[model samples]
Target: MKKRTPKPLVAKKLIQPIPEKVEPIQTEKIENVYPLNQMIEKIKTDIGHSPDVIIRELKIGSKRVFDAAAVFIDGLANKDVIQKVLQNLLVDVRETELCEQAEITDLIKNFSLATGELQVLSDTPIDFNQLYDAVMSGDTILLFDGSPVAFKIGSKGWESRGIEEPSSEQNVRGPKDGFTENIRTNTALIRRRIIDKNLVFEPIKIGKRSKTEMTITYIKDLANEKIVNEVRERLSKIEIDAILESGYVESMIQDETYSPFPTVYNTERPDAVVGGLYEGRIAILVDGTPFVLVVPALFIHFMQSSEDYYQRADISTLIRLLRVGTFLLSLLTPAAYIAVTTFHQEMLPTTLLISLTAQREGVPFPAFIEALFMEVTFEILREAGIRMPRAVGAAISIVGALVLGQAAVEAGLVSATMVIVVSLTAISSFVTPKFNLAISVRMVRFIFMGLAASFGLFGIIIGLLVLIAHLCSLRSFGVPYLLPFAPFVLKDQKDGIIRLSLWSMTTRPKLIGGQDNVREKTAKPSP
Candidate 1:
């Protein structure tokens, strides 16, 4: 279903008295507008030498006309298109003459040199608001003297990176084309996926000031009507000037804005967004971002990837299990080590405990200090690895982690066992598909680590309880964040922790605010 905004928002109404009559949007005013010429001059003054806008004066019928021009940032309006368009206009004026009965209609309709048109639009009215949209979209406006309406010619041109494999999502097999910063191209990608007429995308200009177009796509009959309304309402509530990325949308409309766990899921894969829409979720495509946002999100979404379904079901199940295992390991492994070593040494094998004690013989710090130091160092190295250039990322990660571990043990600043545990935790944190969820798990890991370091096993258990409670109480666009688990939906569990064969998994996850229920039909039932 196509939505004018993102997924639905939580329903909560507040009663407040309405204010007095507010001024309507000034979409057609040249009166108060910073003149096109003035704005261009200011842009040149503010931005060094090059900017997107251009101005040209050309003679027509022995009179020179002053026109304002603009193209998107590095967009399609280059020298070639501009030259072809202008030269054609200068030479072909005699041919564009209207017939006695045809009047202005033929001139307007057939005036386009390219797939679009180029004509004298000399009627109606224009405001700054309308001009703002034209400017952002890279249309050149011709405002003639003594005319109320300005002509907005569609001649957008610029260069952008072709749709290629998304860096964040690399599939072993599937289409490689991912979304780009261009909103139209992204919409086209989705349109190619769902040829069904029901797959709708409503473009909404958000950013009260910047007016960036945010495309909201959904399957009409599949998505819940109530949820769609909620999404539109939330998007309309935004009061910012500009939105550069989907993360901006996230921070603005997220259900739990302060929480580390993301309420909405994001992906760079068209297949993922298509899958989401098929399952009745909404996909929000921002104008200048490749990170397409999907919702209403669940806790389990972060643990999944489209590859799971693409691969054999058995492999997919194993992958899911690994993610869950890593989730636990990333959160509790280092803490578990600290707890056992500090308060429950008897639990460890005698030889193992003795070996660990022997290794820590000359170390000045206790078990907690050693674990904390290694964990902190490992995190720093992980950050450095990510920030480094792509070519050096692997080398930095391997060398920084391995060298740190070896040096810490050799220096007796940390025990060999502690280094191994921290290393394992760091390794496990990278297993999940969703970076947001992984970071959330990493953040919670420190809290558990601190607890285990202070009060041993008991504290770790308490920390787990608190974490679970918070997750259980959470919501995503009004749907329970930890649904199926907290609500105990037996039917939904088939597709939750394990991969039920595609044949068996025939329903969407309940209460995601989706409209569609069926996912498949019985293919050939065995008697």
Candidate 2:
């Protein structure tokens, strides 16, 4: 008999398209010719009667020949300046004998309005979207009865937190000022340090519903054009309906989505962002978020701090070495412990092995299980400390850790040595300068523990090899993640794991600093 033919498997159900109701945005097209009353009604209809949107109607010219209106968000626009503009326009218009729309505009431009930033929209009705955005962003809009264009007066003023020292990126010698939730203030913080003509802040709006503002800051001659364009393109391609913070943009533009490491670096310190910009990097500033993102971040950047450059070269180098050491300890300590006690007991000294064995004699679980339990408990304590209120967070974290560790050891649930190992690992993890990288290390540690539990030190060796290969394979906006060290550029080593004197460091990172790598050629100080 002939072999029966196999039947093709049919899908159980057909995939259906998502149902959506998309209304046309009224602001997309120009409003047809309408009288002043109709325009005012249209504005009201477009943006509901929110108590904050102030619309004040007033008569213009001494004879009251023209009816005019001013519209702005209540708290966002500067009331003092808006009142002054109205006063100057109304009182000064009496002196001009012109009634034509063009004549009135010329008079306003030449003498009527006292404001230095008076802009004419056009002789035709503008799109409601443009009008809405300008008003919402704190600018005052003026509409006249006969004129086709509206006047946009610059009067952006609102309460914002003043500059203060960043809690995350602290330093003893660097500037104390940090980026604020306000995008303008954040850009000004960077501008204060980089006072050059080449410094450019390119603005873009993201989010359909939120209409959030963002700026791409970079030095024209210093930054590589390819990196800048790549950054811009990635940001523009984001089609999300809301971008609340820099993290949203960071996650969207990252090179490796699945990797544990962060490709985009974020910091609250202006000095840090400026330092990155000097090295041919671009900064992304998001409105309403204090943290700003720097692009093409290197793996070493997570280990180095802005304070490193401020300290003496010798001290900086020593501290950098210590951090690197701690990073290795944090990542490998638990796995090494599990591997050694479980599969390589001979590698330990006789006295230490006996002591460890004695400590584990009363413990119920194996070394790997003991270590895993402690690490997870420590992570829970850490998360609780962060989520809890500042007033009680510290006390709770400290007492909880002490109580839990003491109770677990006494209960024979975990060994004392395992507790100490877990504590040391937690302490070492905090040494990383970048919080994102620290999180990545925390996640990767669990994987390493599992590998060590299964295949001993050989499993850990395999894990490290795979980890190194992944790091080498990762790129941050076309720049190698493990740059300078992986590729081994000799000149760039001046500021790698160990930094040399600032004067000796004449050029920026070779890969980042396009054609103009030389930062300073003749500025090396000598005795």
Candidate 3:
């Protein structure tokens, strides 16, 4: 028999193929008028008969001619508001004469429901989706017998954290109040700062199951329409089961997924958000999260603090320069040290080199391993401090770092010089104003360290070039990440590395702010 040819083995798929999108199930509408009992039962069935779903039945009018019932969630709807609504229907309706001439539905909506704002769900065929959504979202639903429509009373109330000074973005002198978990409260805070009628908060609903409330806030004239539309389009495309935090939305809507740098800016401070808005950027406020997300973030935006604009221009400029220096120091210090000690020992002074050599003489590992060990230890300590309870977290981190450094040096696992370098690197990383940016730096620092260990100074220079190219290529919602530096706009340079005097810097960012870029035309003030 002829020798059989060997057959090749095929690899099986590790991931299952994604299923095609399924059409949403169409819910049947409640055609015609539903009786009071039937409507209440239908609602209870749809929303589930939980203990929190309260349905109270009562008679309307003096003669009890009409049957009525009120449905609301227990904790979601304000008890005081629900009580007032019931009083109007029970006591107030009793006082009014029962007349067939006046429609009971109109009478209840016009006089009986004494609430701030309400919507009438009047359709030829009642839509149960609206009814269910209203009931679940802290609205009181009023059902009347023989009425084709239902009354949706706005009674949204829930316990939430009150406004306090933001812990993360604290400044020496600025607005003390910050954004709260309540979306309405956050919008109010923004509105209080900017009284302009042109400032609009357009509402949108996201998340299939959670039905999270979100708003796209921007100044109509100042913000570029294209950017606003782009933001809306991106947000509308997010199809998720739930949006528990702003970060979820940020990750979904951001332009770059693989880049270490943050394309979107998030903050708890309302002033920071308002400041972005003034610069023609858009702010997205998510319900139940104090942190709001600002879009079209540039590289310089993360480095500059809200405090920069609040202080004297000279002082702010100096501080910003210092921050820039610290940022570089944090990113390159470890890599520089590793490169110098490993391959470029000649770069150091004779005495410094002698000291470093003496310090490293007792250590067994090479420069790369020593630095990596110390960096990883510091990262663990930092993470522990953050995750631990606040009362002892700072103490634990401080004592842990000092004790571990001492023990490691004594044991010769790492050298004294390596410990000092790591300490300086950690301290410099904290100088970055934005936590997200700082995290990006922390992550990139390791790559640079690895590069330095491989090819010394040449590897570091190549890495820096690649990093700059990557940053220049990044686009945040269609705007360049390095807005002024890459494009080299002379007018916008005032706010780029160094912030010029407020009056001297007359225009908003060229690409971000729309054509109406003249922020102020005032001449420089003279002493």
Q: Which tens-of-lDDT digit does each residue in 1-527 have in candidate 3?
A: 98665311111211122226423323557654544556676776777678999998987665434677888899898999999989888888743453344567767777768888888888756788877889888899887665666789999997889999998887899889989999999999999999998899999999999999999999998999999999999999999999999999999999999999999999999999999999999999999899999999999999999999889988998999999999999999999999999999889999999999999898999999999999999999999999999999999899999999999999999999889899999999999999999999999999999999999999999999999999999999999999899988999989988888888878988899875788877788889
Query: What lDDT tens digits, residue by residue, belong to model 2 across residues 418-519?
Result: 889999999999999999999999999999999999999999999999999999999999999988999888998889898999888888888887667788
The predicted structure with the larger TM-score, 1 or 2, is: 2
Error of 1 at 389 (Å): 1.9
Clash total of candidate 3: 0
lDDT values for all models:
0.73, 0.86, 0.87
lDDT of 1 by residue, 67-112 (tens): 3333223354555656665665455534222422332223323652
Model 3 pairs in collision: none
483 Cα displacement, candidate 3 (Å): 0.9
Over 4 Å off, model 1: 1-52, 59-88, 95-106, 109-129, 522-527
Which candidate number maximizes TM-score? 3
- Candidate 3 lDDT (Cα, 0 to 1): 0.87
| Structure candidate 2, residue pairs in collision | none
- After best superposition, candidate 3 residue 389: deviation in angstroms? 0.4
